[model samples]
Target: MNKSKSLTIINLAEKAKFYTSLCLGTVAFVSVFAFLFLIPFVVDPAITSLMADYDTVPVTCIATNHIYTEGISNCSWSSCKEGCTKEATRCHQIYVNYSKIPFREFKYQSHVSWDVVETRFLINPEGCGYPPSVNCSHFAKQYGYTTAGTPFPCYYSRVYPEMVVARYSWDDTLRHLVLSLAIPNLLFVASVGVLSYWYCPGCGRTCQKYMHHFPAEEDEYEENTYYNSQSFTKIHG
Candidate 1:
């Protein structure tokens, strides 16, 4: 009976260790993929925002008009069987025009047009997405555009007078920045745990082999009670 009990204890210990190690391995694997895919949204923008290089000065701006982008042209019946859901991209140029400060429009919302397209597609360095998923027909439906001739508050970079922003986003910049740094570090730690768990099987596994000898609190208490009763009977007899 005692021999069988000892074998059961060892088996339990082995299984426990195996599951623990497996969980660590899984976390490490997931962390790696998460960090890689999140780089564009988190890391890139964070680095630029953290630098504090660009200080925006307040400026009054107006949405003069809208010009469509060629992204919709690339869509065809074969390619866009779903009816060309590509959001209309536009020339969001914000610069000084005719003695007035013209700022780039933010998100492309309503005000649809197939003509008046941008001939030269300019890139925004601080923008998110790798291939740019922001401009889409679905995306436009969700967001809204300010009406033309409406005066709104805008910001312009002090150094770059030509550059203009619809609004400033310190909150997103800071949040994404933290997540960008935190996720990679978390991945690194999880990886180290996975490595250490598998690397020293002989060393750690040996200790784990004996872990089942330590009974659960309830079991230990029950056993102790039984042993004390037996000892008391012997003494009383």
Candidate 2:
């Protein structure tokens, strides 16, 4: 009875392993096909977008220059007024704001990094002189002028800020998708692995039963041979 139960368990485990492997193969095949089919629509566009769009805006600024001197002070109030006139203006004031467009902003400097200053500025990597330079107070001061604070402003749409968009990255997107799928695949594979491993114990018991029967069968055969030999000798005598 014990042997029979062992044999039954072994058979069951073997069958379970076989079935589990079949199911895993089938599912893996289906997943591959689905991945291929859905990639053009679901993954391709996301990949293209993540890298292309960053915070950017268009603005116009007018250039101007202003000078003051003691000699010019004696020119008269009318002359001072004339100095402030349109023809004497160094530049015109204009509407220059990035808050109206989509952009991503970061702190100009951080406490962790001592090499920089904290400020707001537009990130324009392709701007004329320098790559990834901001038109912040520091940069402005180099030109012999200064703005009190908030050199770079977020582009405002209505009363709110716009969201910055960028090109999609396959690594980022696929990494997330893999993470979401990993745990479930692990659980299922582990379950199947356990079932597959279970086959040996029952097979061991069945083998033990067959081993025990072999010795008994050998003993019976020996006894029958001795009897037959004795009977043959008696008949010959």
Q: Per-residue lDDT for 45-144 in model 1, tens only?
A: 5665445433443335444533333454532111001212334333232222211233243233344332212111112224322333434333222222
Residues 101-192, candidate 2: write the lDDT tens digits: 22222243222211112211221211112223223233334322343323333322121122211122335555745644554456556655
Q: Which candidate gets the maximum TM-score versus the true structure?
A: 1
Least lDDT summed over 10 consecutive residues: which range in candidate 1?
75-84
The Cα local distance difference test for each model comes to 0.49, 0.40
TM-score of each: 0.52, 0.29
- Regions more than 4 Å wrong, model 2: 54-237
Give model 2's clash tally: 20
lDDT of 1 at 111: 44
Q: Which residue pairs does candidate 1 place in steric collision?
A: 87-136, 87-137
